[model samples]
Target: MSTLEPVEITAGSLHLRPWRPGDADAVFAVCQDPEIQRWTTIPSPYHRDDATGFVDGRSPANWATGTAAQFAVVDATSGELLASVGLQDLRDPAGHPGVAPGGDGEVGYWCAATARGRGVVTSAVEVLCRWGFGPLELARIRWIALTGNEASRRVAVKAGFAIDPAPRSLPHPRDGVIANFWTGVLLP
Candidate 1:
């Protein structure tokens, strides 16, 4: 139902592209990182089937439905998967109202363990934010991380997000326990 088409974006040495079927193996491998499992909503065990479903089903479905614009951030020269970023629709897919205005989206990302500490994710985020602001015409892009995710917080700040001072309650990744979360925002 998307009025938009998925497109490729570039930022220096990185290219953000749509997920391909062949990317299942890389997706599975990246999701195996302990940091990813701990900090993200990805399934704890992160089975191969889960990656397959995401690459073959969820990614395409999101694009087709205009629910999210997700990308596999790759090294332009080597074509290596460095990370994943998404601009997720904040509006309820089931037709309920969203927490923000209609044009708001949420930014989420995870870095491959091998690709961490190198600024790959930060650069990719900057590019994604630009795309969201331009072609997607998003009014705002929000970022959230569980409290204590300093690495993610640093990335958001480095990419120009204004961090909120107050922490909010959010569902834990594994259990539904309420956990403190930090939020940030970037506006067009």
Candidate 2:
């Protein structure tokens, strides 16, 4: 695994950094939004414990092992959690699956309810894609959304992703059912 540190990234009005323990409350609140639950893999009934586990455990562990590089998008001036974005399923050149492996990374993100419609996520995603191409040396970054997730599709398009015409099946994290999904790709 790569021992490289998760560096903070800054954009015009926002900054991205690893999640901290103090972020649990914000995480919990945002994850409770109906829109977030409907579109992403976050626990449908998100609870404090889930948020705690994510900020205190999962986020740190991912960083330490280089399995994923998750970030908390915050307001540069106020330091509020505007959203979450990550480059997941990072692999190496040999195409071995997992942390620090060589290959493409999947981009995932969710914007807080209050922060939607302002292009917060789209801007953050653009910053992350540039980081993936530069510091992370990623060849390509992929995006996927359930077929009806038009908001997410728009963000991908705004961030320069080329949406694929074909739809594929993506398994729901909480249920065994698979749903039709759309995919997009951005090459470095």
Model 2, span 85-186: residue lDDT tens: 999878777766554423688999999998999999999999999998887778889899999999999999999999999999878767869889999999
Estimate candidate 1's alpha-carbon lDDT, on a 0 to 1 scale.
0.86
lDDT of each: 0.86, 0.89
Please, what is the TM-score per model?
A: 0.91, 0.95
User: Worst 10-residue stretch by lDDT in candidate 2?
Assistant: 94-103
Q: How many backbone clashes can be found in candidate 1?
A: 0
Off by over 4 Å in 1: 1-3, 90-102
Clash pairs for candidate 1: none
The residue-by-residue lDDT of candidate 1 on 62-174, one tens digit each, is 78777787899999999999999988764443443332234777899999988999999999999998888776666788999999999999999999999999999988757
Best by TM-score: 2
All candidates: CA RMSD (Å): 2.7, 1.4
Alpha carbon RMSD to native, model 1 = 2.7
